[model samples]
Target: MSDPVIICCAITGSVPRKSDNPAVPVTVAEQIESSHEAFEAGASIIHAHVRNDDETPTSDPDRFAALKEGLERHCPGVIVQLSTGGRSGAGRERGGMIPLRPDMCSLSVGSNNFPTRVYENPPDLVDWLSAEMAAHGVVPEIECFDLSHLFQAAALHADGRLPQRPYCQFVMGVRNAMPADRVAFDAMLTTKRHLFGDAPWCAAGIGRHQLELNEWAIAAGGHART
Candidate 1:
Protein backbone atom coordinates (compact mmCIF):
# COMPACT_ATOMS: atom_id res chain seq x y z
CA MET A 1 0.00 0.00 0.00
CA SER A 2 1.16 3.55 -0.63
CA ASP A 3 1.93 5.76 2.34
CA PRO A 4 -0.15 8.82 3.07
CA VAL A 5 1.43 12.19 2.28
CA ILE A 6 0.81 15.34 4.23
CA ILE A 7 -1.03 18.24 2.59
CA CYS A 8 -0.50 21.83 3.72
CA CYS A 9 -3.13 24.31 2.63
CA ALA A 10 -2.48 28.04 2.44
CA ILE A 11 -5.99 29.39 2.50
CA THR A 12 -5.02 33.04 2.02
CA GLY A 13 -1.68 34.54 1.22
CA SER A 14 -0.38 38.09 1.63
CA VAL A 15 -1.37 38.84 -1.92
CA PRO A 16 -4.73 38.13 -3.58
CA ARG A 17 -7.19 40.42 -1.97
CA LYS A 18 -10.97 40.07 -2.01
CA SER A 19 -11.01 42.29 -5.08
CA ASP A 20 -8.90 39.75 -6.91
CA ASN A 21 -10.96 36.82 -5.63
CA PRO A 22 -14.14 37.60 -3.74
CA ALA A 23 -14.00 34.17 -2.13
CA VAL A 24 -10.66 34.79 -0.45
CA PRO A 25 -10.94 34.69 3.33
CA VAL A 26 -9.73 37.87 5.06
CA THR A 27 -11.22 38.18 8.50
CA VAL A 28 -10.34 35.80 11.33
CA ALA A 29 -13.79 34.21 11.34
CA GLU A 30 -13.74 33.68 7.61
CA GLN A 31 -10.22 32.25 7.83
CA ILE A 32 -11.34 29.80 10.49
CA GLU A 33 -14.29 28.64 8.41
CA SER A 34 -12.12 28.19 5.35
CA SER A 35 -9.48 26.37 7.37
CA HIS A 36 -12.04 24.00 8.81
CA GLU A 37 -13.14 23.12 5.30
CA ALA A 38 -9.58 22.52 4.18
CA PHE A 39 -8.87 20.41 7.25
CA GLU A 40 -11.90 18.27 6.56
CA ALA A 41 -10.66 17.90 3.01
CA GLY A 42 -7.50 16.10 4.27
CA ALA A 43 -5.19 19.04 4.69
CA SER A 44 -3.17 18.34 7.81
CA ILE A 45 -1.53 21.74 7.96
CA ILE A 46 -2.82 25.28 7.52
CA HIS A 47 -0.24 27.82 6.42
CA ALA A 48 -1.81 31.01 7.76
CA HIS A 49 -1.44 34.77 7.36
CA VAL A 50 -3.66 37.32 8.99
CA ARG A 51 -5.30 40.24 7.19
CA ASN A 52 -6.80 43.53 8.23
CA ASP A 53 -10.51 44.27 8.07
CA ASP A 54 -9.84 46.04 4.80
CA GLU A 55 -8.22 42.88 3.43
CA THR A 56 -4.64 44.05 3.79
CA PRO A 57 -2.07 41.70 5.28
CA THR A 58 -0.79 42.36 8.77
CA SER A 59 1.58 40.69 11.21
CA ASP A 60 -0.68 41.31 14.14
CA PRO A 61 -0.14 38.97 17.07
CA ASP A 62 -3.72 39.21 18.30
CA ARG A 63 -5.00 38.21 14.89
CA PHE A 64 -2.70 35.23 14.85
CA ALA A 65 -3.74 34.28 18.36
CA ALA A 66 -7.39 34.33 17.35
CA LEU A 67 -6.75 32.31 14.22
CA LYS A 68 -4.64 29.77 16.13
CA GLU A 69 -7.29 29.40 18.81
CA GLY A 70 -10.04 28.96 16.24
CA LEU A 71 -8.02 26.46 14.20
CA GLU A 72 -7.27 24.43 17.31
CA ARG A 73 -10.92 24.39 18.27
CA HIS A 74 -12.39 23.67 14.85
CA CYS A 75 -9.67 21.96 12.85
CA PRO A 76 -8.45 20.01 15.90
CA GLY A 77 -5.02 18.32 15.37
CA VAL A 78 -4.26 20.21 12.20
CA ILE A 79 -0.81 21.80 12.13
CA VAL A 80 -0.93 25.62 12.30
CA GLN A 81 1.94 27.22 10.45
CA LEU A 82 2.21 31.01 10.52
CA SER A 83 3.91 32.64 7.58
CA THR A 84 6.87 34.97 8.16
CA GLY A 85 6.71 36.15 4.58
CA GLY A 86 7.97 39.66 3.71
CA ARG A 87 4.73 40.83 2.15
CA SER A 88 2.98 40.80 5.53
CA GLY A 89 5.60 42.85 7.37
CA ALA A 90 9.19 43.97 7.54
CA GLY A 91 12.12 43.02 9.79
CA ARG A 92 11.16 41.88 13.32
CA GLU A 93 7.48 42.50 12.71
CA ARG A 94 7.46 39.44 10.49
CA GLY A 95 8.34 37.24 13.46
CA GLY A 96 5.79 38.81 15.77
CA MET A 97 3.63 35.71 15.76
CA ILE A 98 6.44 33.33 16.61
CA PRO A 99 5.78 33.62 20.32
CA LEU A 100 2.40 31.99 19.80
CA ARG A 101 4.33 28.77 19.27
CA PRO A 102 2.28 27.31 16.47
CA ASP A 103 3.17 23.81 15.18
CA MET A 104 5.41 25.38 12.54
CA CYS A 105 6.45 28.68 10.95
CA SER A 106 7.68 29.29 7.40
CA LEU A 107 11.31 30.49 7.37
CA SER A 108 13.07 31.73 4.28
CA VAL A 109 16.84 31.68 4.77
CA GLY A 110 17.80 33.94 1.89
CA SER A 111 16.65 36.81 -0.29
CA ASN A 112 14.92 36.43 -3.64
CA ASN A 113 12.94 38.44 -6.14
CA PHE A 114 9.18 38.44 -6.10
CA PRO A 115 6.88 39.41 -8.95
CA THR A 116 7.54 43.13 -8.43
CA ARG A 117 10.21 43.63 -5.77
CA VAL A 118 12.91 41.85 -3.80
CA TYR A 119 11.92 39.50 -1.00
CA GLU A 120 14.67 40.02 1.51
CA ASN A 121 15.57 37.74 4.40
CA PRO A 122 18.95 38.90 5.62
CA PRO A 123 21.31 36.69 7.66
CA ASP A 124 20.94 38.60 10.92
CA LEU A 125 17.16 38.55 10.67
CA VAL A 126 17.17 34.89 9.71
CA ASP A 127 19.32 34.05 12.71
CA TRP A 128 17.10 36.08 15.00
CA LEU A 129 13.95 34.45 13.68
CA SER A 130 15.41 30.95 13.94
CA ALA A 131 16.55 31.67 17.46
CA GLU A 132 13.09 32.82 18.40
CA MET A 133 11.51 29.69 16.91
CA ALA A 134 14.00 27.51 18.78
CA ALA A 135 13.25 29.27 22.03
CA HIS A 136 9.50 28.90 21.53
CA GLY A 137 9.85 25.26 20.44
CA VAL A 138 8.21 25.99 17.10
CA VAL A 139 9.61 23.90 14.27
CA PRO A 140 10.50 25.78 11.10
CA GLU A 141 9.51 24.75 7.60
CA ILE A 142 12.44 25.92 5.52
CA GLU A 143 11.18 27.88 2.49
CA CYS A 144 13.71 27.39 -0.30
CA PHE A 145 12.96 29.75 -3.16
CA ASP A 146 16.49 29.15 -4.42
CA LEU A 147 18.77 26.12 -4.21
CA SER A 148 21.12 28.15 -2.00
CA HIS A 149 18.41 28.35 0.63
CA LEU A 150 18.60 24.57 1.13
CA PHE A 151 22.29 24.74 1.98
CA GLN A 152 21.68 27.74 4.20
CA ALA A 153 19.03 25.83 6.10
CA ALA A 154 21.48 22.97 6.58
CA ALA A 155 24.11 25.36 7.86
CA LEU A 156 21.67 26.87 10.31
CA HIS A 157 20.75 23.38 11.49
CA ALA A 158 24.41 22.43 11.83
CA ASP A 159 25.21 25.47 13.92
CA GLY A 160 22.30 24.79 16.28
CA ARG A 161 20.36 27.89 15.28
CA LEU A 162 17.69 25.56 14.01
CA PRO A 163 17.16 23.17 16.90
CA GLN A 164 15.53 20.46 14.78
CA ARG A 165 15.67 19.06 11.28
CA PRO A 166 13.44 21.46 9.38
CA TYR A 167 10.74 20.43 6.93
CA CYS A 168 12.02 21.84 3.63
CA GLN A 169 9.68 23.52 1.14
CA PHE A 170 10.79 24.28 -2.40
CA VAL A 171 8.99 27.30 -3.88
CA MET A 172 8.88 27.54 -7.64
CA GLY A 173 7.29 29.61 -10.48
CA VAL A 174 7.63 33.08 -9.02
CA ARG A 175 8.30 35.58 -11.82
CA ASN A 176 11.78 36.69 -10.72
CA ALA A 177 12.54 33.57 -8.69
CA MET A 178 12.87 29.88 -9.40
CA PRO A 179 10.93 28.67 -12.41
CA ALA A 180 8.86 25.52 -12.33
CA ASP A 181 11.11 23.67 -14.75
CA ARG A 182 11.14 19.87 -14.65
CA VAL A 183 14.94 19.74 -14.72
CA ALA A 184 15.18 22.29 -11.92
CA PHE A 185 12.61 20.33 -9.94
CA ASP A 186 14.63 17.15 -10.36
CA ALA A 187 17.80 18.94 -9.32
CA MET A 188 16.06 20.28 -6.20
CA LEU A 189 14.85 16.79 -5.28
CA THR A 190 18.30 15.33 -5.91
CA THR A 191 19.94 18.02 -3.84
CA LYS A 192 17.39 17.57 -1.06
CA ARG A 193 18.13 13.84 -0.94
CA HIS A 194 21.85 14.45 -0.78
CA LEU A 195 21.50 17.05 1.99
CA PHE A 196 18.61 15.85 4.10
CA GLY A 197 17.87 12.29 3.12
CA ASP A 198 14.40 10.93 3.82
CA ALA A 199 13.35 14.01 5.70
CA PRO A 200 9.94 15.44 4.86
CA TRP A 201 9.92 17.97 2.01
CA CYS A 202 7.20 19.80 0.07
CA ALA A 203 6.81 21.84 -3.12
CA ALA A 204 4.87 25.08 -3.82
CA GLY A 205 4.14 26.69 -7.16
CA ILE A 206 2.82 30.13 -7.91
CA GLY A 207 -0.32 30.77 -9.99
CA ARG A 208 -0.72 28.50 -13.03
CA HIS A 209 2.04 26.07 -12.08
CA GLN A 210 0.43 24.90 -8.84
CA LEU A 211 -1.12 21.70 -10.12
CA GLU A 212 1.94 20.77 -12.13
CA LEU A 213 4.20 21.20 -9.13
CA ASN A 214 1.77 19.24 -6.96
CA GLU A 215 1.83 16.34 -9.39
CA TRP A 216 5.59 16.42 -9.64
CA ALA A 217 6.11 16.47 -5.90
CA ILE A 218 3.65 13.64 -5.31
CA ALA A 219 5.01 11.50 -8.15
CA ALA A 220 8.49 11.93 -6.67
CA GLY A 221 7.20 10.70 -3.27
CA GLY A 222 7.41 14.10 -1.54
CA HIS A 223 4.65 16.29 -0.16
CA ALA A 224 2.50 19.04 -1.71
CA ARG A 225 1.45 22.57 -0.75
CA THR A 226 -1.74 24.26 -1.99
Candidate 2:
Protein backbone atom coordinates (compact mmCIF):
# COMPACT_ATOMS: atom_id res chain seq x y z
CA MET A 1 0.00 0.00 0.00
CA SER A 2 1.05 3.60 -0.62
CA ASP A 3 1.14 6.55 1.69
CA PRO A 4 -2.08 8.52 1.80
CA VAL A 5 -2.30 11.41 -0.67
CA ILE A 6 -1.80 14.93 0.59
CA ILE A 7 -4.09 17.41 -1.14
CA CYS A 8 -2.68 20.87 -1.68
CA CYS A 9 -5.13 23.55 -2.75
CA ALA A 10 -3.80 26.68 -4.42
CA ILE A 11 -6.50 29.18 -3.50
CA THR A 12 -5.31 31.89 -5.89
CA GLY A 13 -2.30 31.84 -8.18
CA SER A 14 -0.12 34.71 -9.42
CA VAL A 15 -1.67 34.96 -12.88
CA PRO A 16 -5.43 34.64 -12.37
CA ARG A 17 -7.66 37.53 -11.32
CA LYS A 18 -11.27 38.27 -10.48
CA SER A 19 -11.68 39.49 -14.04
CA ASP A 20 -10.27 36.23 -15.31
CA ASN A 21 -12.67 34.40 -13.03
CA PRO A 22 -14.67 36.19 -10.37
CA ALA A 23 -14.36 33.06 -8.27
CA VAL A 24 -10.68 33.87 -7.82
CA PRO A 25 -10.21 35.32 -4.34
CA VAL A 26 -8.32 38.63 -4.25
CA THR A 27 -8.66 39.87 -0.67
CA VAL A 28 -7.18 38.28 2.43
CA ALA A 29 -10.64 37.57 3.84
CA GLU A 30 -11.86 36.01 0.59
CA GLN A 31 -8.81 33.77 0.48
CA ILE A 32 -9.43 32.56 4.02
CA GLU A 33 -13.04 31.75 3.19
CA SER A 34 -12.03 29.85 0.07
CA SER A 35 -9.27 27.99 1.89
CA HIS A 36 -11.64 26.98 4.67
CA GLU A 37 -13.90 25.35 2.07
CA ALA A 38 -10.96 23.47 0.63
CA PHE A 39 -9.88 22.33 4.07
CA GLU A 40 -13.32 20.99 4.76
CA ALA A 41 -13.21 19.11 1.47
CA GLY A 42 -9.86 17.37 2.29
CA ALA A 43 -7.07 19.79 1.37
CA SER A 44 -4.37 19.66 4.02
CA ILE A 45 -2.20 22.33 2.47
CA ILE A 46 -3.08 25.79 1.17
CA HIS A 47 -0.57 26.96 -1.45
CA ALA A 48 -1.02 30.73 -1.39
CA HIS A 49 -0.24 33.82 -3.49
CA VAL A 50 -1.45 37.25 -2.45
CA ARG A 51 -2.41 40.25 -4.58
CA ASN A 52 -2.54 44.03 -4.45
CA ASP A 53 -5.74 46.08 -4.31
CA ASP A 54 -5.81 46.18 -8.11
CA GLU A 55 -5.70 42.36 -8.31
CA THR A 56 -2.07 42.21 -9.38
CA PRO A 57 0.38 39.87 -7.65
CA THR A 58 2.36 41.28 -4.76
CA SER A 59 4.88 39.78 -2.32
CA ASP A 60 3.69 41.84 0.61
CA PRO A 61 4.54 40.26 3.94
CA ASP A 62 1.69 42.07 5.66
CA ARG A 63 -0.84 40.47 3.32
CA PHE A 64 0.74 37.06 3.84
CA ALA A 65 0.73 37.54 7.60
CA ALA A 66 -2.97 38.38 7.51
CA LEU A 67 -3.74 35.38 5.33
CA LYS A 68 -1.75 33.07 7.61
CA GLU A 69 -3.58 34.34 10.66
CA GLY A 70 -7.00 33.78 9.13
CA LEU A 71 -6.17 30.32 7.80
CA GLU A 72 -4.85 29.18 11.16
CA ARG A 73 -7.97 30.50 12.87
CA HIS A 74 -10.42 29.01 10.40
CA CYS A 75 -8.77 25.85 9.12
CA PRO A 76 -7.02 24.66 12.26
CA GLY A 77 -4.02 22.49 11.26
CA VAL A 78 -3.95 23.28 7.57
CA ILE A 79 -0.43 23.86 6.24
CA VAL A 80 0.20 27.34 4.85
CA GLN A 81 2.66 27.04 1.98
CA LEU A 82 3.34 30.46 0.47
CA SER A 83 4.62 30.77 -3.09
CA THR A 84 7.91 32.47 -3.99
CA GLY A 85 7.33 32.12 -7.69
CA GLY A 86 8.84 34.74 -10.03
CA ARG A 87 5.41 35.91 -11.11
CA SER A 88 4.73 37.35 -7.64
CA GLY A 89 7.73 39.70 -7.66
CA ALA A 90 11.30 40.26 -8.81
CA GLY A 91 14.51 38.96 -7.24
CA ARG A 92 14.43 39.02 -3.43
CA GLU A 93 11.01 40.64 -3.40
CA ARG A 94 9.56 37.21 -4.10
CA GLY A 95 10.89 35.91 -0.80
CA GLY A 96 9.63 38.65 1.50
CA MET A 97 7.19 36.33 3.20
CA ILE A 98 9.81 33.75 4.12
CA PRO A 99 10.66 35.54 7.34
CA LEU A 100 7.03 35.40 8.35
CA ARG A 101 7.75 31.70 9.01
CA PRO A 102 4.97 29.93 7.28
CA ASP A 103 5.02 26.09 7.51
CA MET A 104 6.55 25.99 4.00
CA CYS A 105 7.44 28.15 1.02
CA SER A 106 7.59 27.19 -2.65
CA LEU A 107 11.21 27.19 -3.84
CA SER A 108 12.19 26.92 -7.47
CA VAL A 109 15.86 25.90 -7.51
CA GLY A 110 16.30 26.60 -11.22
CA SER A 111 15.04 28.95 -13.91
CA ASN A 112 12.82 27.98 -16.81
CA ASN A 113 10.78 29.53 -19.59
CA PHE A 114 7.18 30.40 -18.98
CA PRO A 115 4.56 30.96 -21.64
CA THR A 116 5.83 34.38 -22.73
CA ARG A 117 8.85 35.14 -20.54
CA VAL A 118 11.70 33.57 -18.64
CA TYR A 119 11.00 32.68 -15.03
CA GLU A 120 14.33 33.74 -13.65
CA ASN A 121 15.62 32.11 -10.46
CA PRO A 122 19.27 32.96 -10.78
CA PRO A 123 21.82 31.13 -8.60
CA ASP A 124 22.34 34.13 -6.35
CA LEU A 125 18.59 34.56 -5.84
CA VAL A 126 18.10 30.85 -5.24
CA ASP A 127 20.92 30.84 -2.71
CA TRP A 128 19.52 33.92 -0.97
CA LEU A 129 15.99 32.50 -0.84
CA SER A 130 17.19 29.12 0.43
CA ALA A 131 19.40 30.76 3.04
CA GLU A 132 16.54 32.94 4.23
CA MET A 133 14.25 29.96 4.54
CA ALA A 134 16.96 28.09 6.44
CA ALA A 135 17.55 31.01 8.79
CA HIS A 136 13.85 31.36 9.49
CA GLY A 137 13.52 27.62 10.22
CA VAL A 138 10.98 27.20 7.44
CA VAL A 139 10.70 24.13 5.24
CA PRO A 140 10.90 24.49 1.49
CA GLU A 141 8.66 22.70 -0.96
CA ILE A 142 10.88 22.48 -4.00
CA GLU A 143 8.93 23.41 -7.13
CA CYS A 144 10.45 21.26 -9.87
CA PHE A 145 9.37 22.45 -13.33
CA ASP A 146 12.19 20.62 -15.05
CA LEU A 147 14.17 17.50 -14.13
CA SER A 148 17.29 19.55 -13.47
CA HIS A 149 15.51 21.18 -10.54
CA LEU A 150 15.47 17.87 -8.66
CA PHE A 151 19.24 17.59 -8.92
CA GLN A 152 19.58 21.20 -7.86
CA ALA A 153 17.49 20.47 -4.79
CA ALA A 154 19.81 17.57 -4.00
CA ALA A 155 22.88 19.79 -4.33
CA LEU A 156 21.35 22.41 -2.09
CA HIS A 157 20.46 19.77 0.48
CA ALA A 158 23.91 18.25 0.39
CA ASP A 159 25.48 21.67 0.96
CA GLY A 160 23.37 22.33 4.10
CA ARG A 161 21.10 24.83 2.38
CA LEU A 162 17.84 22.90 2.21
CA PRO A 163 16.34 20.99 5.06
CA GLN A 164 16.48 17.21 5.21
CA ARG A 165 14.05 15.42 2.91
CA PRO A 166 12.65 18.56 1.36
CA TYR A 167 9.20 18.08 -0.04
CA CYS A 168 9.00 18.47 -3.84
CA GLN A 169 6.22 19.51 -6.15
CA PHE A 170 6.39 18.62 -9.83
CA VAL A 171 4.81 21.23 -12.11
CA MET A 172 3.82 20.08 -15.58
CA GLY A 173 2.08 21.15 -18.80
CA VAL A 174 3.34 24.69 -18.73
CA ARG A 175 3.87 25.68 -22.38
CA ASN A 176 7.65 25.75 -22.70
CA ALA A 177 8.39 23.83 -19.52
CA MET A 178 7.81 20.15 -18.83
CA PRO A 179 4.76 18.76 -20.53
CA ALA A 180 2.13 16.48 -18.95
CA ASP A 181 3.60 13.44 -20.66
CA ARG A 182 3.53 10.22 -18.65
CA VAL A 183 7.04 9.23 -19.71
CA ALA A 184 8.48 12.49 -18.47
CA PHE A 185 6.40 12.24 -15.31
CA ASP A 186 7.70 8.75 -14.63
CA ALA A 187 11.27 9.86 -15.20
CA MET A 188 10.77 12.71 -12.77
CA LEU A 189 9.33 10.34 -10.18
CA THR A 190 12.20 7.92 -10.70
CA THR A 191 14.74 10.70 -10.45
CA LYS A 192 13.14 12.01 -7.26
CA ARG A 193 13.35 8.57 -5.68
CA HIS A 194 16.89 8.13 -6.89
CA LEU A 195 18.01 11.41 -5.38
CA PHE A 196 15.75 12.01 -2.40
CA GLY A 197 14.86 8.42 -1.51
CA ASP A 198 11.24 8.19 -0.32
CA ALA A 199 10.89 11.87 0.39
CA PRO A 200 7.30 13.00 -0.08
CA TRP A 201 6.43 14.66 -3.38
CA CYS A 202 3.39 15.95 -5.21
CA ALA A 203 2.34 16.79 -8.74
CA ALA A 204 0.48 19.79 -10.17
CA GLY A 205 -0.58 20.40 -13.77
CA ILE A 206 -1.45 23.60 -15.58
CA GLY A 207 -4.95 24.33 -16.88
CA ARG A 208 -6.47 21.29 -18.59
CA HIS A 209 -3.73 18.98 -17.42
CA GLN A 210 -4.45 19.60 -13.76
CA LEU A 211 -6.86 16.75 -13.31
CA GLU A 212 -4.67 14.41 -15.31
CA LEU A 213 -1.57 15.04 -13.19
CA ASN A 214 -3.61 14.79 -10.02
CA GLU A 215 -4.83 11.37 -11.09
CA TRP A 216 -1.37 10.28 -12.18
CA ALA A 217 0.33 11.29 -8.96
CA ILE A 218 -2.27 9.75 -6.70
CA ALA A 219 -2.42 6.52 -8.70
CA ALA A 220 1.33 6.27 -8.57
CA GLY A 221 1.10 6.48 -4.74
CA GLY A 222 2.66 9.92 -4.52
CA HIS A 223 0.52 13.05 -3.95
CA ALA A 224 -1.67 15.53 -5.81
CA ARG A 225 -2.39 19.27 -6.03
CA THR A 226 -5.61 20.84 -7.28
Model 2 Cα lDDT, one tens digit per residue, 87-206: 989999999999999999999999999999898999999999999999998899999999999999999999888867778899999999999999999999999999988888999999
Candidate lDDT values, in order: 0.94, 0.93
Q: Measured by TM-score, how close is model 2 to the native structure?
A: 0.98
RMSD (CA, Å), each prediction: 0.9, 0.8
Residue pairs with clashing backbones, model 2: none
Give the TM-scores of the predictions, in the order they appear: 0.98, 0.98
- List the candidate 1 regions with Cα displacement exceeding 4 Å: none
lDDT of 1 by residue, 1-226 (tens): 1879889999999889888889999999999999999999999999999998888899999999999999999998999999998889999999999999999999999999988899999999999999999999999999999999999999998888998886899999999999999999998999999888988899999899999999999989889999
